[model samples]
Target: MSRIEVVAPNLKVRLSGVTSTIIQLVPVQARSLGIATLGPGLPEGLPKMRWWQVPSLLARPATRRMRIWHARRNVEMVAGLLLRWLFRAPMRLVFTSAAQRDHQAFTKWLIRRMDAVIATSARSGSYLDVPHDVVMHGVDLDLFHPPRGREDGFGAAGLSGRFAVGCFGRIRKSKGTDLFVDAMIELLPRFPDWTAVIAGRATPEHLEFAQSLKARIAKAGLSDRIVFLGEVPDIRPWFRRMSLYVAPSRNEGFGLTPLEAMASMTPVVASDAGAYAEMVVPGETGAVVASGDGPGLTAAIERYLADPGLAEAHGRQALAHVRRHFPLSREAEGVAKVYDRLWSAR
Candidate 1:
């Protein structure tokens, strides 16, 4: 078991959920793989100081004490470069943002200096100008697998009779939740049994926008057709209740919710952003829409809602895709091999 330290410094609530999923993956399968955090409140119940500032705060001598570091996100690059210089901590930087292209050259340069790299998808791989490997984020098939309705609260909440189209993950403009809501308004007349749900935490910047969304529901006379269940600790129960899942992200390194939806056997309609083109496989595993196309989202949602057998077919195909290309063991093994190769080079 090789110990690896992950240093993602996010104070946001949503960061914890995603990072926790990653931290649990590398260590559990890689035999004692470990993480050290540097930032304001990390995503998981991580053990370490708020390392968000550690890169900028560390004294030269202090940095020399550590051996390996994992920098999370592109924003942390400056600190990553400084630490690499101070400690020679053969670091492996992970990037999930596709929003920045102007810095790609510099990012590529910095990545090449690192011992190795890990990309979540081919789009994510393009950020690297060095030796790297692709490791699809692994989902706990058991935890997220076809969720059983052990309790009735999720269903009994009166969302049971409708075609539930739920979206999960951080709520923000980039996530395109507003666009999803607009599409929901369009579908209310055609599909009276449809409901759109906004799950996960929304940023303070978007809180007013969420209110506007709720107001739109009331104004459109579709309050009965839409709902908002704010952030919850465990998503399994929520995922279980969903009949169809939607993703309208302006961007994604890789959308984990769609896979979670597939694991739950809920059908998916997603924006063709980042890795969705490769993973979703329109008309096969799931339906996909243009990033901001409300009509496309509405049309795709209607298609899936109108055809349960097709939804099941696409969902089954999605399950098979996950089992073949993105299983935890496959992802873990790919990453372990990369670690082995990097160590060999050292």
Candidate 2:
């Protein structure tokens, strides 16, 4: 078998936030380290190997430095362990946990077998039983950054209003897309300069729910003002077109949209779901409101809408905050450190 080698071998068989994380991290990490993804559904540009290639990939002499099988899900973790035991692969297993709740027995048992565990946020770490590293997720600054002129960006995209408030993600109740629509219906009429945009796909399951939101917008006679542009091919420019971004998820593992908005130099109004409170600096980057509270969402968005200057000022801080604290390179470096320690110990 032809050998494929890498120090960090990422195993992701499913499409999810975990897959997104791997896609985001591997390209950046590959710049400085030997890393490759072993999975399906990752971006085609990423260096990847087939499952059948795992044996020779692990046994090659170039891989003698001791590699890592990084898993982000239970199935991937079990696969990593099996590779080591069943195939005698000389690689350590690492798992990154984003779940904030207590682990089930099977999951806890898997966690015990991992050589290292990484929590995406401090709050996530609190739920772990063993020692773990908190490596907060980061955004690709080059991909998600400020536009030269916000109005021009919006104009080019055919979206109206001088200032746009956007909620970008899956269009469902759990994501609080309905809450965003409610807040916009209440606030959009008062601020003509500010239009609300909801850009996301409503799956077959949530199509009715999404349609209900559209009906509410129409009933309020604000169809033009409250635009639901459904999922776009590129979310970066959509973010740039916005002066303010909102994330009103009822719950999250580690919501990255707020961070993406911040990186794009757009001020945010996110609910206290996920690690949003930790990611967004209240009054600096943007405000974090109570989750599922319509009045609170209204009030927070009102804060930004009422003072355009405050939103602009906070947008500047948002850009700097992301650059200083949450660069994608930094996250890759943190994971590299974990790999380094695992290599040394093994």
Candidate 3:
């Protein structure tokens, strides 16, 4: 077997943007280079190295002078450091920062130890005290594409609606789930043909919040119109079913859902949080509203509800925009260059 030149560590077992990134990009990167993911919860299809293979990393590979350990989380960074410094593994550490907030002292310390750093967006890079490259995340074009026909998507969902508008993410205040529900409550009644879909799960702490939103829907007699499908296994098909997508997040660390929706040829109405503002092209692809502005979110979504033709045109533009700027291959290539630079410096 070829020695692994690059190892992308996903320390978290739960599904997240970081985990999704690894799952999507590693396969693309592996086609041209010696890359494999290390850690848990990844699909079996991807190229992966086992925990038992740690000993082999102690020696320098004949194919490369040193292995590159790419870490997306603090725990993953710490693991890389232990391998290189504590265990004397022949590896170079690289960290990717997606957080758009000020780093804690410990996080700052961990970052300083990395040989190279990558920021998911320019906004993310601003929060980093150290030098880093800005490499935005991308969507898999093959996995998410425009539906052959409108019914092709809606029929698969088995939902009763002529049109669908959706918001997908964790059901929590920070993610602006309540804001999405409020927007739907006000708009769905106005446009009787459109049904609002919310896909994601609320953890133990936010179950009450999710229930409260449901109660609000029931109180307004719009529970049937507003459907909640908790934590979907595959969300690509749902994106195809939507006529519009809303990312009303109050906070985020370079979110990817908007891009995924765009790739599905679904126009977006997103709040100016994370990289939503960066990803969306107002009036052309979609609109961007201020974070936590319930009125603005409702108004933005209403534009599509009022005119479906405009929405469809904008969806076409959105698909083209994402194809040009945010293909998964582009992201993999950008990340590969960073790895190449580290290797060249050796």
Candidate 4:
């Protein structure tokens, strides 16, 4: 029998850096301040820092970076709490972006007891009555910038140049990819020239769903109407090719993709869920529809599809919103400040 013990150390620290892309302007700063991160796919460029694998903690029984624990998802918080209890240490847990922040008393209380708090969106911060920081999750600004060609390339991409709607990212129910598909099915007949390009992989459930969606499109004889560019590793071209972007996610702690699409100068069509309200302004930077309503999604998409020249105007507004609100270094710097403050206190 091979067994291992994890000594949670005098001060156990947990870090979930799954969202922190190494090249992003902010994460570089957090690592410099010794924020021990644990999660999948850490940036290889990070220095020889003490990064403990949450699962491998059982064998090490070491506790060096156990002072300031920060995470993004609920799963990360659970792992941090267990580590703190196992090590008999006082933990300062900070969840970067949480979905169930409204009615999540247990999760909220568990995190509030910690020394500090952080939220990625204003809505997430609004609920808490504590000393909290709203540091949005950032994107690779260099990678996602104003698209080239017509600034309206949708014209060339088999779209009417008036109504080219695009949505990318993993195909899933939560992402509302299904909603987008259904909306397109209902609206495409009215505007046969309008195109909806669905990109990215699908979950097992949605794999079948994706197939069904494809079947429906084919059955409706819309093989050319709705294009499926599945799982594109290089999404820049897709962003550049579309006049409008769509995100119907059921929920999001912080919708970074819309930000990325905005940064790429693509006007958005998103549900008023999670970070969409903060990012997309109805009839402004982008359009917003009621959450869980397929008709709303259809109407919002059609608004931009109806007027693609507004794409440039709408995209510029979206870009300006992102520029004024969320800068790249914001999240990492806030996280760094937390570490500096905590470290200095110690």
Q: How do all models score by TM-score?
A: 0.81, 0.94, 0.97, 0.78
Residues 1-346, model 3: lDDT tens digits: 2478988888888989889889988889989888888888999999988989878889887699899999999999999999988899988999999998999999999999999999999999999999898889988899988897755477677777788999999999999999999998888888988999999999999999999999999999998889999988888889999999999999999999999999999999999999899999999999999999999999999999999899899999999999999999998889888988999994
* TM match of model 1 to true structure: 0.81
lDDT of each: 0.65, 0.85, 0.91, 0.66
Candidate with best lDDT: 3
Model 1 scores worst on lDDT over the 10 consecutive residues at 57-66
| Residue 186 miss distance in model 1 (angstroms) | 1.6
The predictions' CA RMSDs to the true structure, in order, are: 4.6, 2.0, 1.2, 6.2
lDDT leaderboard ranking: 3, 2, 4, 1
Ten contiguous residues with the weakest lDDT in model 4: 1-10
| Model 1 C-alpha lDDT per residue in residues 74-139, reported as the tens digit of each score | 446656676667755445544433321334576666666666567777776775566567776767
Model 1 accuracy (lDDT, Cα): 0.65
Clashes, model 4: 4
**What are the clashing pairs of model 3?**
none
Name the regions of candidate 1 deviating beyond 4 angstroms: 1-21, 30-67, 74-84, 88-109, 152-154, 160-162
Candidate 4: which pairs clash?
Answer: 8-87, 11-66, 12-66, 13-66
Q: Which candidate leads in TM-score?
A: 3
lDDT of 4 by residue, 225-245 (tens): 788888776777678676788
Ranked by TM-score, top first: 3, 2, 1, 4
- Separate clash counts for every candidate: 6, 0, 0, 4
lDDT of 2 at 171: 85
Alpha-carbon deviation at 142 in model 3, angstroms: 0.4
